[model samples]
Target: MDKPTRLIEFESMLFTRHTIPFNARKWGAERELDRSAYVLLSRIQIDGPLSISQLSQAFGLDVSTLNRQTAAMLRAGVVERIPDPEGGVARKFSITTEGERRLDADRARSIRSLERVMADWTPDEVAQFAGFLNRFNRDIERLEGRPWPRP
Candidate 1:
């Protein structure tokens, strides 16, 4: 195939692959937390507290959308709003102990599912795939000027 054709095929495959994690069988059905809440908790865990505006910029989402999501999170006790550590007027969201516990459990479940799916893959193959995926994400983040902090 020509390069352009190949790129198109790759993009389609990427979207298909992205859906795997969101599949109910893989990660959704086993968790009480919705994907949005899990993702928000994960971000706060990695990046520290962040205001809705900051999260909106990082995720390329609207402030109103984040406001709604964070409101739900607050009701669930997954996060708490506090004065921004940077002394901003806006409040930032931070994960609570309950959120941490739930996030960790959900993450463990997802990892187990992935492990089962990749049971036949060699360790080297797994490591190489992880490296490539990480590189791809980092490059995109760089271009977007919203690089996630490295664990």
Candidate 2:
């Protein structure tokens, strides 16, 4: 097959595979956080506090959209706005302890789900798949000039 044709196939498979977990109704029911909240909480936990403007830039979302999202998170007690730790005047959002607990629980559930799905796979196969996914994400981040902070 031509490279272009193979790339198209890959894209289709990617989208299809990505939806599997989301389509799992049982898993979805177990989630306390929605997609946007989970992503925002994870980012805050990893990158430290961030202003709405910063998050907007990072996610390519508009400030108003982020404002609504953050407002919801605030009401849920998942995040709190505080003065920027870097001595900036603008307030920044930080994940609350509740947010951390929720995120951690969700992460554990995701890992367990993945483990169950890959139960038949060899350990090396699982490791290799994870490595490839990480590499793919890093390459995309590099191209976008938005490298995520690594632990």
Candidate 3:
């Protein structure tokens, strides 16, 4: 298959062009959180006390962007900076109690949304869809020359 044709079809299945902008609005209306900030917080809450550099790399963002987001989180008391136990020039951040509360609320809302969307789906169908989605992601990464990393 031609690369452009394949890419177009894959993206169409994965994303709705019209609904792309709508997701941010929906997420914000549901939680009073900006989509970018919410995504940043979710990443941190799931995988922190990580350094700013780590986050920047993981999210494919620049240092400045990560710093700005981290600063906002700190000001909101959603994340706290701590001296890196690993001893670095960089400081580490951990999710605070408020952060956990926010994460839990967001998770609950997401679960409800997913449940409602999938109400008619059978458990077996859901499992198969999830499995295929995972494989699709892996295949795309491979095609892009990103070999899957070890867990």
Candidate 4:
């Protein structure tokens, strides 16, 4: 009997491989902040100050994991915890001035990386691709029962 055919998903593999190298370079260049720290900072920058619980829900991480992550961020002076002022038992976490600086640097680095990758693509093509990527993310979120921006 012939051997069973193997299924291939080149697109998934290609994208995953691309990110592995991209994030490796990113993490290597910015040794002060690990990838999770960067991601948490970025989320705080976008979502504003939020309680640990809120962050836990958003990231789907448990409280203990978030607590450790936040503690490291606090020690690095990247984030500060303050009273929620919204009637919460737990304090809220906000990006510190240093965090903003780091975030800006990271954003610039990311832009440079993207520019290098898309140097051959036209602005129109980039825009279309970005739109498709956004839509794809939204669709995935929907499938996972997550809320996304309304049209």
Off by over 4 Å in 1: 1-20, 26-29
Candidate with maximal lDDT: 2
- Tell me which residue pairs clash in candidate 2: none
Residues 1-151 of candidate 2 have per-residue lDDT tens digits of: 9998899689969866664334445555377788789889989999999998899989888999999999999999999999989999899999999999988887777777778778999999999988977897899899998877776
At residue 101, give the lDDT of candidate 2: 95
Question: Model 3: per-residue lDDT, tens digit, 41-150?
Answer: 67776666879888876667798988888888888888899998788877898888888887677667666666666789999999997798788778987776543343
Whichever of 1 and 2 has more TM-score, that candidate is 2
- Displacement of residue 115 (Cα, Å) in model 1 is 0.4
Local lDDT at 17 for model 4: 67
Q: What TM-score, to 2 decimals, does candidate 1 have?
A: 0.85
Off by over 4 Å in 2: 1-24
- For candidate 3, report its TM-score: 0.73
Positional deviation of 94 in candidate 2, in angstroms?
0.6
Screening candidate 4 with a backbone cut-off below 3 angstroms (N, C-alpha, C), the clashing residue pairs are none
Candidate that would win on TM-score: 2
Provide the TM-score for each candidate, comma-separated.
0.85, 0.87, 0.73, 0.81
Mark the 10 consecutive residues where model 3 has the least summed lDDT.
18-27
Give candidate 4 misplaced runs (Cα > 4 Å): 1-9, 20-32, 148-151
TM-score, cand. 2 vs. native: 0.87
